[model samples]
Target: MRAMVVAAVVIALAAASPVLAETVACHLTYGGETQVIESAPLASPYAGTPTAIGSFFLFRIIFVREPADLARINLYVYAHAEFGEAPTPVQHASYPYPVSNHGRYGFTGLQRVYEPKHESELQYWCEMRGA
Candidate 1:
């Protein structure tokens, strides 16, 4: 049936595409420095929620440039992990002077054990400019 064929095609296309999460505007700050990076809608997936690793939370971040931009730019990404009412810095990572203007870049911070026996939170930010 025509309806069946259309459904099959839709399923095939969905399977071929990569799963993407919402893109959020973030302010990255580190060592008395701060910057904001605007990401394109439908851009490649960069970061995800921290995963539980035993008694610790593993933080991660991925950065990808928009395909429309041909200019090479350096991107600096920072991730902060915290627990309890007061956030305590647990990890810091960055990608400096990327060779390519396009593609995926990633960083994984050192695992930090959960404190106060509760789930931790993650904050992300980045700065980008011409190399």
Candidate 2:
């Protein structure tokens, strides 16, 4: 029947792309407020973008699950825009894929990133989930 054929095609597609189920989550804290950002595996890192956090920080996470050798997660922390200017990157971190045991990786406790112009500090750390 047509229904059976459609089900078969769906199963075939799922089997061919198991990596679609993977995801990464990053936790960010600044100005006494905490936020979590989650990212799914991407086809291209360049497709990712940073998120605004509070009034002083911007955060971005890139998770890629293809090309086995290049599978990884990348984190970027930046100073949020001031006076309509672009956000400024303040820190970056990278982690390899297959993060075992839902592993927690990032700063020991909390780390600091300083905004270049005013030397203001931002705190952050991240963990991988559903990896």
Per-residue lDDT of candidate 1, residues 1-81 (tens digit): 999999999999999987664332344333334344444333354434433322333333444445645322223222333
What tens digits encode model 2's per-residue C-alpha lDDT throughout 109-131? Answer: 35678877766677766655543
**Ten-residue region with minimum lDDT total, candidate 2:** 100-109
Q: After superposing candidate 1, which stretches have Cα over 4 Å from the reference?
A: 1-47, 67-88, 97-131
RMSD of each: 13.0, 5.5
In every candidate, how many clashes are there? Answer: 0, 0
Q: How close is every model to the real structure, measured as TM-score?
A: 0.27, 0.70
Q: After superposition, how far is residue 81 of candidate 1 from its true place, in Å?
A: 8.9
Candidate 2 has what TM-score? 0.70
Q: What is the C-alpha lDDT of each candidate?
A: 0.39, 0.73
